[model samples]
Target: MKNINKNRLFIASCLALITTAMTFAIRARLETVFGPEGIGLTLEQIGYAFAPAFFGFTIAMIIGGPLVDLLGIKKITWMAFLTHAVGIVLTLLADSMTSLFIATLFIGIGNGFVEAALNPMVASMYPEQKTKMLNRFHVWFPGGIVIGAILGWLIMDVLGLSWQVMVGALFIPLVIYGVLFFGQKIPVTERVQLGISNQKMFSSVLKPLFLFMVACMFLTAASELGTTQRIESLLKESVAKPLLVLAFINGIMALGRLFAGQVVHKLSPSGMLLYSAIFTFIGLWLLTVTSGGMTFVAAAVFAVGVTFFWPTMLGFVAEYLPETGALGLSIMGGAGMFSVSIVLPVMGNLMDNASAAEALRTMSILPAILIVAFFGLHMYMKKRQKTFEV
Candidate 1:
């Protein structure tokens, strides 16, 4: 404990998350830049181009998760830095759909590495406050999106700067986090420190409850990311400044996550997931019918719903299923991203053949599924707690 710099490590982790979140904002803006109106690529093509971001994340998390133990978190973290640097430069140079796809792939891998490394890192560092601290740590995800969205608006929309400038903004956080992590003493993961063998970790992930959560991860991630990733296209005709709306939604999310401790205490992780699904379903359906100023209200509800979804899901695994270790967290994260990767193209096709409103309604179905799943989870957990009590 004397050697561990919890404050510095937590700050560095937040910086890494901010870097990851900026990519989402930049990619959202890029949708318009490379869309049929701009570069003449169809929405489906843009979806394909963006596919790498999620799947690449899946690959990195799956690969890096196991490696975090063998290679060490420090090594995996630096790996993320290297990949993010390469991805940013490639994105700046990308013009065609093929080039964009490759660049996004690299960024997605980098983003995956960030989560693969940092989520476990934070969980390890704060064992007593896993859910609360992880939620605080995740504030940067939406917080960074808010920064990136505003920067994109100011640089491209208000100031008329090149999109390249917006891409360049990623370098600032990238450099800061690198400096913070350098020469710092990194800790072994909680699993390794507790002497949990690799076999135990792997087997834990195969358990019925763990597998169930992974299944739900797919739907939860798609409901949140699939919708937000295509916010520009979905809200194009319905809103004035979609990016601002994106910013507004993430802004609320950032604030909500910052104070997640109170909520997690009251609702429990399973309860939170159940409630999030409820709000998300309502929000998505509302967006289908709303326009103009009312769009922000609907987005607000959606943001509140998804605010706890990602980090809370990870936190639940880290807390209740601690035996699954880094690999478990990685598999959960990888599953979510992989699902988004699949849904992105389908959503793009929906946009092409149907309306954006129709796409929103379709995305709503994901959370609708989660509602039933999480309700089952809540009941299962309650019954298990009762068994333990007896």
Candidate 2:
């Protein structure tokens, strides 16, 4: 804590995440611009273009995770700033599929670096409050989406401004975070402070439990991100304002995550995951059957289910499996994004050939799997707790 500016660093991390979330909102808006009725690209093609965003995130996290210890968090933070700057400008220039894909690649890598560096940074700064603080740090993700969604509604819907103007707005946060992080001293990760070797960290993540969580990360991420990413297409026929619905879902998520400390304390991480899975299953099923204003109600339930998912999953590894360190966190994040990358095109294909409701029904299956997996995880944790208590 000595000589470290935790507040400044945390604010910078939030800004970085805001930039990431804005991309989600802006990309959701752009789906219409590049869709079959606009530039004549198929839904599947749009999915392919967007795939780089997630896969690039996977690549950057996998690379940045181990390097966070070697190259330092500040270096990764600056890397994110530079890449986001480049990605924003590139997105503004893009009008075709190839250009959009390349732009998203930089943005995705930047997003990954943000998570890779900051997740561990938050954990290091507030070791005792890893789950609570991490949830607070991640609040910006959904919060930013809300901001971006409103901006899109005003700028494009009301003001009738060009999408390029919306893309240019990202520079505001990009500059603010860059300035905040500049010349700030970042502390070493908690793993390094505890003297955990890199090899031990790697081996810890190879354990059956860690691997099991990694697999679950795939399903959970797909259940949340894949659904949100395709919101425009999924609900276009069912709702009048899909972007508003996106904002509604993320708004609920932001509020839920802000109060995550209460939920995490009450349920514990395993219990939280179990309940999230159940609620997510119910919410997705409801979405397929509901329309109009009722869509918002269903989205609220879905948001609550996914609210604690990303942060709590990371928090669990940080608290319960601290030995796995930055690499472990990065791997979980990377696996999640990679799974979303794989599913985006599949969902897009389903949208092309089948109804959006059918696509939604298929997505519900992800949370259903999570419900079963987290149920097992919950029981296993309870048994382990009793053994420890005895």
The digit string of per-residue lDDT tens for model 1 on 145-178 reads 9999999999999999999999999999999999
Q: Count of backbone clashes for each model?
A: 0, 0
Spell out the clash pairs found in candidate 1: none
Name the lDDT value of residue 5 in candidate 1: 93
Candidate 2 Cα outliers beyond 4 Å, as residue runs:
none
Native-referenced Cα lDDT, model 1: 0.94
Candidate 2, 1-390: lDDT as tens digits? 689988889998999999999998999999999899888789999999999989999999999999999998999989998898999989998889999999999999999999999999999999999999999999999999999988988999999999888888899889999999988999999999999998899899989999999999999999999999999999998899899999999999998889888987888899999999999999999999999889998999999899988998999889889999999999999999999999999999999999899999999999999999999999999999999999
Local lDDT at 273 for model 2: 94
**Model 2 TM-score on a 0 to 1 scale:** 0.99
Q: What would the TM-score be for candidate 1 when compared with the true structure?
A: 0.99
